[model samples]
Target: MNHPLTDVTRTLGGIAYGGDYNPEQWPREVWREDVRLMREAGVNLVTVGVFSWSRIQPRPGTYDWSLLDEVLDLLHAHGIAVDLATATAAPPPWFTRQHPDARPVTASGTRLAHGSRQVFCPSSPAYAEAADALVTALAARYGDHPALVVWHVHNEWGNHNALCYCDTSADAFRSWLRERYKNLDALNDVWGTDFWSQRYGDWEEIDPPRDTTAFRNPGQELDYHRFCSDALLTRHRAETTILRRIAPRVPITTNVMGTLEKKVDGYAFAAECDLVSVDHYLPAADPDGHIDLALNADLARGMARGRPWLLMEHSTSAVNWQPVNVAKQPGEMRRNSLAHLARGADGLMFFQWRQSRVGAEKWHSAMLPHAGTEGRVWKEAKALGAELAALREVTGSRVHGDVAMLFDWHTWWALELQARPSDQTRYLDAVRDWYEALWTLNITCDLVPPDADLTGYRAVVAPSLYLLSDHDADNLSRYVDQGGHLAVGCFSGVVDEYDRVHLGGNPGALREVLGLVADEYLPLRTQDHALLEDGTRVRQWVERVETRGCTPVLRFADTTDGGPAHGGPAVTRHSFGRGTAWYTATRLPVTALREVLRTLCAQAGAHPVVDAPPGLEAVRRTGEEHAYLFLINHTLDTAHVSVTGVGVAGAEITDGRVVVPPGDVVVVREDLTIAPA
Candidate 1:
């Protein structure tokens, strides 16, 4: 909620650099060596006790603080900050032995054995009561610890206990429903439970929404996903409440896995966190991985708004979890990390300070990789740290940009409710498809939520807009009617907040302004494309609609199954008040799609930061002192870049617009004092 400043003021910088380091995981003598190496590498902070529930508690209440106390004192003595953990994610074996109901039940109805983290059920009052007591004890114990900057609540929640459906969960779900609907009648009407001859006169009659018979409703499945997210948030809120009473100023956060679908609701959780942090892991040559990373960073940046985000954890070399544990090439880590910085990042830390000796993640790479500090990975870490330390100001200073992309959740929820075409058209995929297109153009943009003001934007692309509030609809209408350039893909403006489809045809809410009707849709599964009057589409068949009062800019290539048309307006524009609204009837391939976005952006008065060579990537960061341009080539082959001077007032820092060799990262900050001539 901090808004734009969070992105700029915070800067793509790191204050407390380092990751989780637990000397307790190793021998006493090694702790000294670890501290020495940390100082040598310019490590500023370390996160400790993430999965140490058993370590801290030992045996249910015995309280062995000897090792933990020493570790904390040791790290603090070395001038290293710490992100102290609550250690409540994993329960002591004795607690579960005494209370069996505390075990987490999975979606497939299997019980999670003890020893796994996040095995405690969120709905269990006993579990909450235990977790609350432990968290309070930890906060009260370390409430004034100087080395600690924040409290890391429950580790990576929703991994194990995500879809809990135990008795406690069932009861909690019923309570949550009562609070949400206030009564059973409303719930029945919204869920359409009446149609199945299943009328719940009382709340207890409703069980968890699951497949009891052969018929599996996707709507119910989607709601269950949403409910689970809410449930985890409820737990986070409860735990953070207790901690807040004692340590009010210290931020409370958890390392969130980027784009977790059926787990914690990160957007909602944003309300609780003082600063948002996320885990980032990208594949070496993943076809969609790069774009996926962009979406993830944009999503996290959106959550943080005007504040800087934390790169909580990423593989230094290669993570052991993926199907293939590919090592990061010589420059991949620096390149990818800088890419994260270009977006918006405040801090960088890995999962563990030292690799785990035991557990599922024992093999994950760390600063102190399995090869000690003598290997290439550790050497790179040292170099990265040095670069950050020397360039701290630019690293911390804010970047300025005005344009923002309009991102909406209701639209995401409503897209799946599309009555036609096919039920498989996903909302995020549609949004990602559009976002990736824009990204390829090297244009600077912010991924803003729907509620954000659209007036500042020159162009706004809202893909797969499913549900819109009356006010939101009005805002977009005026934005378009008043000279703003707007673009949205198919499956937009179909529903309201109650998850009800708009009564009219497709885009029922904005049909008047958009000036089009999509009576039929052609689902194209192939990556082939076709051009119409307006623009060409990249994915599957296009929307076949009648150009009512507006104009038909394009047509379909062919018809399907006796349909009159196969394609309708692969792209179209309609003037409202003084502006325009554009709709894309078909999914556009990334290359063609960026061309479309580039055209719209040009119309909106926003141009690419700079043209680059084939493999080179360009991103611009504007500051009061000077504007910084980051050019990086992630590919193996060298790429050439062409550039006119970046608009800077002072000393022209141009090394000639030339080819940036492969795997090269170029940083140029204009010296504003020099005369333009």
Candidate 2:
């Protein structure tokens, strides 16, 4: 499948830039003004008809093409390409009323009312048929439209209604289990149902892990999560099948919420898309949201298998959903957008072009805010559009990473079950902690799956990988044996894919490779802390480690002071085969973690792209002709980076340095002929 970036660059002649265009929300006359503004802002592409199901199909069988036809024609006439949606994201009221069985039910057996979007059950046959019928009609109508460049299957799958515990979904789950396990005996053995006397004699006796009195079966809960994700994928594939049959040439995609999202498995979702597209909104309350943004961009690019992906949706300013919606500063939005581009986003877009007037998201930031063209958001959008227009040559380029960070949704699900270590130990927090450590060092890294090929990466880091399959464990062992560096964080490799224990000490799978035996887990109490030998602060979790052959680099502080932790290794390094494996038995602060990773990376030959200050982010994208070096200055003061290339502003006389203003971005096109070592 061809990536949308490559296709958009070929057909539209530059990077794709635009936002969602909802013509149904406004009068026809307002659309002309919208297009005029879009052209002024340098938008070359816009998504249409995402939430227009009710507008398109008011009744069960009736169709209205007047509004969508005019919208597409007008966009084409204005030289703007269209990312036409399947319009199945939200079903109309009439259809829901007719097929009430398709309505989603809660885990407690309550049928949810259809007032919000994505309210239909994912496994409901009626819902699938209805969605497919709508998708078929849309594809058959606009499959060959001149303005159509991409097929957006559905909007943010599993965002609102991820799992449906209704009977319809129950039947589908039973069928899926039958196909997966082949028989009740296999299912029982895998689920470890004998412990709770929950073993099923017949497939019909099974149900989803609903709200039970006691702790539900971890195995069943984990499988239910997997089933829900796959059910959503099945619906997505159904829509894509019809689109492929009708418009095989157009690239198909659905936006995925990156690392922070725990519902859908991003790896599975990425495989289904022709190209990866993601929707990321900044953490409104966090002081360091940009770090989260960088993690998301890296994860999205990783899902694309290192191919250039698209920024499908973001906010121009404050999103309406946060507890206290704080607006973006003067240049924050620009920095945010360019930051994604610097990572690997070939295209940039927003949630909306024009802000809504009478919807739940009316206050959500958009290209055209409620204050109209006179607002600061509008000006920044225009400036960013022009900047993107100039950087068209960077499209289809690749961002190469020096290290690979392992992330898995299944591990996330299994690790955070009801009964585990302290709830303070979170899966995403561990991933982010390690990622931030790498990011702070200016070390470019790829977010990869556990079983990914680690031949090229100099170092691989696995954080909070609590669930491990035998195949993936062997893959990691093989990677380390082949002279690849491996760093295993705490609570990793503790359980198999069935959510059952490894039947030995903690971190069971990689214990042999790590050359250590974890005798017990020591998750800290709330507000408690532990200290390393060198006074490095550790918190949340720790492990009592007994090294077999590896040497301990950091151990618990002595017991004379009487702290929460007294002895044993906090971190260890094992020389295995031709490579090295590092183990972190306790959670270290970002500063401490960075130093540890820095040491490992230096030994493994994984260095930074450029040695600049901590706050200045540097990433390079290489193409056939040139290599574009993107520098984002997130610090309070200006930064002087050492580099020699043609600036985006066409500045040529380089004195081996580029000065980036605070909270700003700089892109320099270097010669690709001088290949990177």
Candidate 3:
């Protein structure tokens, strides 16, 4: 299937190598220099009007498009394209003052102030009308501009005020429940409201899960999250409808904060966009953060269904938000950009084109820093643009993965609720632990939703899946029965969609396929650890399992009380149909988990593109005519990797045994060969 932005000539022409450009913040004289410097840096695209709502529409039903018109015309004259934004990210102060109900209210009943962005209540009818008007005006004015290529809808949704408990939201929540349940009786039954006299007598009695003395109903909280996601999506769809009508040829999208922010569902939002775009910010202090960044990129690619997506926003150096803002070390910026391209990003862009002299994010890095072209950041930025220009052949390629990892927003929300088996059970940490192990083996993976098609993957890993719907559970069983390897972590398959415990056994729905039924949970306190059969210690949580027809992969060697669990199975493997299912009863240490994953991949007939050392990543992107291999080294030490599977004649191999220095990238291309039978 071809994406809306698949036409390379219309889209960036090569790799989009620019970022957010705020020409309105500077004087008209400065705008000319900005364009001149953009050419020197090889910038081809810039995102404009992201936060200019107050400037463009200062009053009710009034707009001044002179500034935007000058900006777009200037960019076009300099051969730069524009990703025009609707500028509806934040409402103007006049609108909020006129309609105070548009301000979002916290769960504690305090209305959020209007100074920050995204302060409007999603359910407010007045806010919707004003937002639609702004988008309509922008689209109608700039729809036929020669520079306009893509339409950027509102900025990051649910970034600040994800959930609101105002009366407007309460009414909308009730209406949503009515559509879902159709009656108060069904709602009461599904929420399991009988325990605390919380059964609703009417739809009006239902409220957004607000601040309370005790824990609120898990089911209700989960539904509130869903409602908030849908509410924002409704606003997006409204704006998209106007853009499609006015500029039917341009693709519409909104930048998503993937894995960085948890309030929005990426898959649901991606479905609404003509193309998926993500913003990723790596931690400055953590040396191992590149792995997490890779995970986020993979998630964004999966949201786009393996189609090429855009890297919307990333800092050129230190950001102002963290406690200690450390600048990017030498060579880190280039390696980071290539990593995203290797994963599946079609374009590379940063947060800002020029540094802001006054603002909350004044210190945030930009393509052109305050120090100008003399700085290291500017040098690196120019060098990267040149490299991307040389590698334009990589455009319109796709990356394929042999392994799939489950990433569900519902599971993340339900697992991290107020109550749980252990306080140390973090959903993302568990998923990353498994992903880090796979990365260590140089394997590529795709982050998939539970209900996504499983036929493409040879093995699937699910970690901390606390909430499972009936459809998802049945889908997993069928995948395993049809000869696919399945690996699950502890605290999985424990509850249904309504947050009610599966009563028959722990991991209730998957017990038959896993060949083990857990009877009770054994949570470890801080500083506590238990010994596994391999002499590696497991911590945080453990479960007591009784195998039905499974082979013990590892057993518990030590227990808290020296009880029945001391000799029980800590990990089990079962044969289901022509496939195998493996289960871990606790979180294994990193070294041990890596060993186990290596064995699992071998058993599943899954191999990496190359056998490289730790901190070196290998990924393959293939086109119909040729294939490219990307080897990136994240560590400070030099890496020497041997390449394989490229023996076809006339293949252009950069280096058979590539020598990648610290924080560097190596790309190798091979021509496709036709096999004769």
Q: Residue 320 CA error for candidate 1 (Å)?
A: 2.3
Shift in Å, residue 420, candidate 1: 7.9
Pairs with steric clashes in candidate 3: none
Q: For model 1, what is the error of residue 467's alpha carbon versus the real structure, in angstroms, after optimal superposition?
A: 4.1
- Candidate 2 local Cα displacement, residue 7, angstroms: 1.6
* Candidate 2 vs 3: which has more TM-score: 2
TM-score of each: 0.90, 0.98, 0.97
The list of candidate 3 runs beyond 4 A from truth reads 8-10, 558-564, 644-655, 674-677
Q: Rank candidates, lDDT, best first.
A: 2, 3, 1
Which residues of candidate 1, in runs, are more than 4 Å off?
1-14, 216-222, 260-262, 284-288, 399-402, 406-424, 467-471, 525-541, 558-564, 637-659, 671-677
Residue by residue across 606-671, what tens digits does model 2's lDDT show?
999888987999999998889889899898998888887789844333588888888878888899
Error of 3 at 266 (Å): 0.7
Per residue, candidate 3 scores C-alpha lDDT tens digits across 268-335 of 88888988899999976777878988999999898998898989998888898888888888788888
Cα RMSD, each candidate? 3.9, 1.4, 2.2
Which has the higher lDDT value, candidate number 1 or candidate number 2? 2
Cα-based lDDT for every prediction: 0.70, 0.89, 0.87
TM-score winner among the candidates?
2
| Tens-digit lDDT track of model 1 for 58-151 | 7766666777788888878887777788888788888889789889776567777886677788777877877787888788878787776778
Q: Number of clashing residue pairs in every model?
A: 22, 0, 0
